[model samples]
Target: MIRKLALITPWPDQRTGIADYAFDLAHGLADVGIELDVFTTCTKPSRTISGVRIQDIDKFPGTFAFDQTVYQMGNCSTFHGEQLPVLFENPGIVHLHDPALHHLIAFFLYRDDTQDYYRVLRAWYGARVAERVQTFNELNNQGFWDSPHVTEVPFFDPVLEHATGCIVHSAYAQQAVHSRVPNLHIRQVRQAYRNMQPPAKYNDGEVLQLGAFGMVQQHKHVDVIIEAVKRCNAEGKRVHLHVAGALESVCKDLPDLAKSLGIENDITFHGRLSEEEFLYWMNNVDICVSLRFPTMGETSAVVSRALQLGLPTIVNNVGWYAELPSCVTKLPTEHDEMLKQLVAQLQRVSTNGEQLAQWRAQCRRYAQTTGSFEQTIQDYVRTLACFRTSAMAA
Candidate 1:
């Protein structure tokens, strides 16, 4: 039997990790003979990419672009209500992106169950003038407010009950789906991971280079990381920081931060890099620090990439990174606590050559064994195969 996959995500001119993952999945599926079509919110659909059929939604002469149409459906716009039926018309499996897509889906589930007679009567008598009232009534009606489909995903069991299967990035998400929707069938797979290859001489250096990977931002703890490095340098440690990435949105307080610290010369701002330059920077990085401060995610694609290239890393103990074996030091995001860990980790990595060597080896081993690109693709291949099974689709 021929199998087709209708992958829906934010694509075309894609930049994010998820976007790249979608591309990789589509490419891998094609390599194995699966028919794939991509519909995305990004650029107008192209007819083909790397041999897979890409439907340019622009050809539809529709109300909005593919992304905009689906975006509203997520927002619960009555206009967006049209896309769901169309999503079902595709002769393949539907792969949803993230949690934010639910806004529009909620309205459909509510209207499907427990009719609202009072609002119906009001709207029946008053058509054009009552548009606002109908929308409000539709949103406010308590009968459908907490419906299973609206409240939870696996709970919306029936909506996806027909879907071949669902793809999620992490074990945590898989557990969440199972715990919430035990009867639903799901295929667990790790999303693709990438890493930068740190040069072998990453540590055989005179100047200690600590990079913030982007402009100074609070979430990234750019300011705090700077302060910690300053403290370390004052304590006879020779460490400098190179802040890379495009400074598209400037942080408001970074100027005053440099002046107050009085170590402005110690830092080099690489502004923004073209795609080629950015990869070059990653390839040369001694340590890639991911500021997962204030929140935790399942994984960090950047961290994974650096590990692949044997780039030693110091990450905030957020996400699944706590499980990896490395010189990973978890510290409170507080300015004080961050300073202590930063200073200590820098001093150790600079002077303790043996320890730094071991940390680099750990990064290489962990990333190579678990996060190799081939392994990630294999996981998805097995997962999509399971979804393609006729029995599972039913």
Candidate 2:
């Protein structure tokens, strides 16, 4: 029933994950006959993408002309910097990409308006929560806030209070948000990747290539994969790790760690790749190792891309990744155990061609079914229609 709609998200030129996702979603929705006016924070002049109109966020009219407005929300400041205030002021359906908004909220408040931050925190979560946030900030000021643990109290409640409905990419996110706001309407949609032809199966006698994509950080456990690769090499298996993404500041030490571990020669860092270059690596890699601990309750677009390319992936058994099909290998939570298991998996995949082939087949089947672009777009349209109907009824 929803006809004209406003879609707010970062555009593809930003080169962020959500930017690419939003770009594709906009195109898909347009293909399905939805009228969309896409708004981005990018300062570039207005243009059109895939038949949908794109405009700067600052030009958004004080009131919407569409049936509803959709905000694609995330924690990263680079993309969400200008969208945060708009989200709070013009409440609408929110597609929350991450469960915790603490980082996003804190960045805006601490950098721009500290008083408003405190006032909003007190209003949303009460004085005790505000006090805890203040104490956390004090520790951060003293250079003592370096832990990898996620905040137990996510700061997304304020946004949820104003949302007409919510869309999350995973059940874990749905449950987490619902636990906090029991009556909120939350819909879980399968995250989508661009449709791709399945890469040709690797032939025998080629060196096994392992890939780790996206932002490299300590939590992503890129270093652990290096250690596992070292173990595989020590055992006489010829394997190489090809990392494709920007190295986060915290994980800049990864190259040094690899050199110290004597596996520097077996790894290649392809930082900030273009779309074609990324797809080239995807077509060539044998397997993908993407593990994370203390997940942000967000789905992995990289893993979804791997599946779409018919590549087997290994992820830690936590958060949204845990919900992936069994074809995607899940490692144990403990670091030491995860490394050992990864080594074992590498050995098995290298020695057992049949099992590897089966894994690739399973990935292809999953890509064709649950990860299809058509299905994702249909689900989104249905969800939006239902949300509109409910709003009208109320």
For this target, which candidate reaches the highest TM-score against the unseen true structure? 2
For candidate 1, lDDT tens digit of each residue in 1-394?
3355455554534444455555656766667666666655556532246767665433333322221111111222332244455545432233433322334444554356424432443332245523533355468744222232322222223334445456655454455546644655565555454333345555467767666674344567777777876787777777777787544454655645766888787776787565467668777656777675543233555565566676777777643555545545566566677667877888897777787778877766665566556666666656555544232334
Worst 10 residues of 1 by lDDT: 65-74
Candidate 2 C-alpha lDDT tens digits along 1-394: 7778898888876767888888778878888888888889866633256668888898776335877788898878788868767766777788999888777777767668877988987887789977876787676743111233443667787667767789998888999898988877889888876566575555455578999998897789998899998999999988899999999998898889889989899999999898789888888888989998867777888888887777899999998899988789999879999999999999998878788888888988877666478888989988977564222112
Query: Residue 179's C-alpha lDDT in candidate 1?
Result: 66
Which stretches in model 2 have alpha-carbon errors above 4 Å? Answer: 45-48, 111-119, 126-151, 200-205, 388-394
**What's the CA RMSD of model 1 in angstroms?**
8.9
lDDT, residue 24, candidate 1:
58
CA shift of 386, model 1, Å: 1.4
Task: TM-score each candidate.
Answer: 0.68, 0.90
Model 1: CA > 4 A from native? 1-3, 12-15, 31-33, 44-49, 57-164, 193-203, 214-217, 247-250, 296-298, 325-327, 333-335, 388-394
